[model samples]
Target: MAYTIDRHPGPDAPRLGAMVLHPIAESVPRARRWFQKFIAPYNPACSVDDCALMISELVTNAIVYGRSDDPWVVRVEWFREGASLRVEVHNPGFPASVRVRRPDANDAHGRGLLLVDSIADSWHSGPSPFGGTVVSFVMADAWPS
Candidate 1:
């Protein structure tokens, strides 16, 4: 999907960075990369790899469940707020109805939200200003590592 990457810098820290891409499988990896670089400066406090994994899951969900036959876009953005790191994924679809559920022992799928729940300090979903579902998650600025 055609896309654009825009990075905004703040004197104290990275302000807001965003990417808009067509909802597709490849967008998942791209999202992860953008997220990693966006948070690179703060990796001393944040877990970049964990954040990237969450990005992958959210982007995958958007591509797999949030799109239709009509062309639409998925957006990713991240920024720092005090001692918190916030990430959001917005896609073209109805508001997300996300919930955490137990996965079967042998199940290979259906664990996206669960992973988010366990990893993120807090998370939620709602309608996006850009005309679709938005799922946002936040993690503490300082991780155990």
Candidate 2:
């Protein structure tokens, strides 16, 4: 399935921060920290710990599944839409490759997207305008009144 890459936050949504990370295992922690710090100023109502965990999982997936020899980079962007927070992880991968897997108890892998589904208020995966896959999630009412 071909997805329009223009799916992004609108004018009303303010961008918080964006980072282009190397497609490496080490980038996961960095992405989490960056997300945590950027959203800290907003005092989101959502749990920062849960957000961080989701970011970590997404970044790890990008590094593992989205890796390619040509463009070895992953982009992570965050935006604030009123009380909601939106995050996107972009990589040179296929949208079909991203799915919520049903992992067994013994499996060490295949649990990333499941965590995202359970923790995030909403999430989606599609092609990025920049020529790759983009997996995004939204935490509604993230900001406090």
Candidate 3:
């Protein structure tokens, strides 16, 4: 229910780049570009578009709930192991444990993670020692050179 939000260093990256996206509305466009460029060289299946959407939804969550004064962070890193691409969207904190439910007719909010859940081939959320929760998604693809 109550989760802390903080930035803690994560696993060693073996890919293009890892960025810390500030939890600000103005930062979304720049954040999407970061993901596009990262997958430009490899061009994996359903990768570029999917990754962008993933970033948008995850970062949007950080911006929405991280509270303007709370200083939220979106830590994103990509790595390929065997036959999968692992994309982790690290949030400073996790809200109360709530299942992803379809919104009612008048609902406009609460669909961010819903998008993440539907689009991402696989995803999960867990506690972060850094003080929050990191929601991760993985798309299966061959290793790139």
What TM-score fits each model? Answer: 0.83, 0.88, 0.77
Query: Whole-model Cα lDDT per candidate?
Result: 0.77, 0.84, 0.66
Give per-residue CA lDDT, model 3, range 103-124, as digits (tens): 9879977787788888777888
Clashing pairs in 2: 45-142
Candidate 2 ranges with C-alpha deviation above 4 Å? 1-10
Ranking of candidates on TM-score, top first: 2, 1, 3
- Between candidates 2 and 3, the one scoring higher on lDDT is 2
Query: Which candidate leads in lDDT?
Result: 2
| Candidate RMSDs in order | 3.4, 5.5, 5.9
Worst 10 residues of 3 by lDDT: 1-10
Backbone clash numbers for all candidates listed: 0, 1, 2
Which lDDT tens digits does candidate 2 get at residues 14-62?
Answer: 6777888888787888888877876787777889899899989999999
lDDT of 1 by residue, 1-145 (tens): 5344556557444545778877778888888887676566556476779888998998888877785567788888876666777888888767745667699989988899899999999998998888779998998765342
